[model samples]
Target: MTDDRFLYDPDTAVDPLGDAEATRAAGRSSKHNYAKVGSGRPSSLLYNYGPGAIMDLPHFTVMSTGLDDWERMWRKRVDSPPEIHAPRLREVVAKLLRSRNVRLRPHPNQPRKTGLSREGNDLGVPARVFPQWMRCTGCDLLAPLSHFGYTNTHPYRPDQARFEHERCPGRSGSRSGKNASRAAVPARYLLACVDGHLDEFPYDQWVHHWSPCPKVEFPVLRMVDRTAGKGASAVIHCATCGARRPMNEAQGDAGRSKLPRCRGRHPHLDAFELNGCGDATRLMLVGASNLWFPMTQSIIVMPRSANEETSDLAARIRVAFASKPHRLEKYEATGDLEGLRDALDGKLDGPVDEEAIPDDQLAKALGEALTSGESDEDLAKWRADWDPVDLLVPEWNYLLTDPLGLGHEDEASGLTLSHRDRAPGLRKEIVRVLAVERLRKVNALVGFTRIDDVDRVADLSQRMVPLARAARPAWTVATEDRGEGIFLQLDEPAVAAWEAQVEQDQLWLAHRAAHRRNFESRTSDTAGPVDAEDRLRPPRYWLVHTLAHVLIREMALECGYSAASLSERLYAWPGSDGRPPAAGLLICTTAPDSDGTLGGLVQLSEPERLHRVVSSALYRAGRCSSDPVCGMRTPQDTEDFLHGAACHCCAMASETSCERANRFLDRRFLIDLPGSGIGFFGLPG
Candidate 1:
């Protein structure tokens, strides 16, 4: 293994929150970079410290001296703090009870050691029985508790799991309350395979720190390209400990997503620093989990005041209480937020203090926020609507964001090299992934052309109606600058110019052929009627596929997904929890000046890829000549192109380029930069 010291120089002192001059040094450097492409050692060794750094070091020695121990301690304390011992809790209870002077009324129905609330219910559960519950400070037995295993104060689900003294055993099943409480989070939070397969310990073990991450730092090896354009932050989990957390609260501190900014200084931050684990226990629980392992990064950080935590928790609880609940089943099944609201009855307006808001009304409001989804503004409406006394603390962020732990990179292997500009390439990969999906969808459209299966043809035929009128149609939302002026948007304006274009372009071959084969005999190679001599080939299909990709990309941009995120959203084609780049439909933008010089351009919305290639024909003249304008060029240029125009493909870009004019405009390719064009509009591109 390479010198561990190189990769983690805790001695230099790093302020991840940017308190000090944010230190940037190589966490580990190599004279010969095994992580690079040509390094003969193979990229897999990079996780094992490449040829220069240690990769697969067992986390057992994480508690060793220096920064590695600091990281280890940071992970353990942040993820799963040492389990509170029964005796220790009892002492705290004695102290608190002694100071408060409270008397408990005996209930005849309750068990011997079980404390009861006003209602005849168990108050505190033993850690063993309710795996999520805490140990009772006064009683040594498992009592029904309210805090563990998150509960909805009202009915968010059909099954009302909450009670005045509700007890729940989460993922860990228990025959008795005993087993649930004792099984604290395991020792190792992460599991990394030699092959680079990393697994997290458990979802529930993570503490969602609501704070903005300044920037990722590594003393030895910061990804050289991280300071480029803004993008969403990743959810990085510790490879050795499996402790996981998000790098930022809202897709990085950059205003990339629509979420409001979260405010707070790093609270759970380690007071000290530990670079690595010091022990070999793969899985251990209880405070004893720290016995062999040195408290490497233990800084003796001050605990947040009860007022701070309580107020924050109470505010979150209020938001949850003010939430509108909706049916999750339909939301997942249909992806219809409006329909989901209707099914759940949405949220009701007005006051709740009138003896008044019916339980069903409260349930409706909860469903509105849950199913319809809530905005930041929806959170402020907690006054007079919710009771802090009976609040349900939900993972509000989780419910709002599409998915959790997404975009997280690997730690051990250090999969993140200087590939910052690779997002466009990532978009291309996403498109490729989605293209396969579109092809898969063709299977459903197979064989629908035959006369008997002809009835089903109307389903697709109805789409043709809108297809016929697609050209020059007005769009709902308009982008500030139409990409038509530049080489990117002006290409191939007639992708779906009319109903006939689909057939003329053979856009539906896969789906049409697949659906056609389903019902009847395949007679015509063509599905719907089209112009003569058009054949389906790879180049031809790729051209259409590219068009489909363009459409998806345009729609994705409109739907609030950035070029960086296009690939993420399109890769999976989100059903509910996930957002698969929006390949649903496309929005066509027609520049008013498309009169032959740079005719119309077609933009596809919700494309499947991140880096989308828009093909617009250009000539030595520099005009974006698409469709009929192919005839505008002389027949001489036609000899080379078989149509006199050159097919020029560009990604999303702004401004126009003139190549043939006396003083030709040189199209400067903006390297890793997003877009170097002048003006604020070009900044985000």
Candidate 2:
């Protein structure tokens, strides 16, 4: 019988490698010992001795002469590919790929020839035909068989390479897979300034490509000092004292030659030392923020210097009026500055009391409200301040000095208390989410680039951050790894912190609203009123505060807050603690802002955003409130607004006073302090 196993029929129409061909390697037959048959088997003796027997032999097997000869003839190195060491060889090739960036691709169909796919011209070897060709996945560049460095495991043969990831080291960097380029551009993706406010890198400002964490949408701010790594940061020597200082306040070595904090507690350098440095090495100067922004209101407060008589930052600003308070007397008395100052400071002789009346002033003020003629009358009566302090007195009695931080609101804590604590503690997390989302919206409005464009995202985010800061600069954000990412967080803690800043911003807005509304002209001026000049009119600081309100609200809406909410949050009277408390009655909303200056293309009108902002402030924490004047109504009025959210109507006695009234600070005394500089940090430069 003829055995066809191990057959190598080259030119035949019938292929030996056909699907129906049975594998003879695994069968047990006399033909399986074809390589050993010559030792003793009849098959080997008969097959070799008789020429007729040759036709009966297996198709591809030949008999061996002896036992050793059988092994030798069947296992020649030239006869078989190395399959036993396949696993170990694969490992070696993998290691080589890691070390030398080599990859393999066999010629298609295991042929011996192929061409390269790389950009540069590289010739490939032509054999029978390549089973595969080589390709450099890194940089998407490829090379032919001869170019790659061959090693013990990775058959340096060109057709044996595999696919690899394309490495992109960016423009002007390395041709290798790991080269990062040197960049002189602004090394930040997102910037948070010293004020705890956030800004981002604009296209014009960002030179390096932004590569933020794919997982973290809002990247935090970080910075890598080149000097810190290369050398012990550029040493700054003082000219006169010759004092050597390192820069940046994050590290203590920095001095305040240019930076005030670096200068010293007082941060003042004598001319001799200034002459020594001569700007050769400008000492680290304390600034508005790590990131630059012009005209931001978030103040960088200085530490109050001791051993000085006038270093108090909280100095009573002398109520200095660059212009006269817009009182009726200012127009009538030809600017009686002396009389006006005396009346405002409570210098009139008569007891500060409301006059006996037919309620004539209210009637006269109301009658004037209809025609816009009384706007001037309304303005006058509004300014006739029995005592601006009186309106503030009720507020002081209820402020919570000790604040319970976010989340852990226990009994007596600001978060759990009823009235003493309040103000929507504008959480950092809240602000960040809103800022990023709003940036996308603004980008949509302007139509420059998509929300995902790293450059555009950075720019829009920065421009819209003032909305979160609400007129104050928050933090400065820089990038880590030079310019690969962003670092945005609150800058330095204000002497008052975010809570106080919010309160002050809101307070000034209210005070100014009252002031602006006071200009109405009424038919008759009430007599015996603490003199005509002592009106509750807005002052310069108040107007400045109102201006801040306008800007913040505008930005917040551009971010997508409802107009009503925006106005309400902005309107809410923040308590000592930054969250809104029971002072709902104190929330003030007078008139909307003046028309937009940005032409017809960009009209900033958002009633809902304003309302939400104000309402959020009102609901921070309070037992209850009933201020019909502002139309702010709280659902609960018995518990402290900053702490617990209890229903006072159902739980507490109706006649109970709010909890905050009992814990009020001696604000009256604080306000009446004789001179300036009472702040933790003294007045600014």
Model 1 lDDT tens row, 408-432: 2223111111111223422221221
Model 2, 474-531: lDDT tens per residue? 1111000000000011112331243354335433344334332332232112113232
- TM-scores for all candidates: the values are 0.17, 0.16
Which regions of candidate 1 deviate over 4 angstroms? 1-500, 504-685
RMSD for all candidates, in order, please: 29.5, 37.7
- Model-by-model lDDT, in order? 0.22, 0.22
Best by TM-score: 1
Worst 10 residues of 1 by lDDT: 437-446
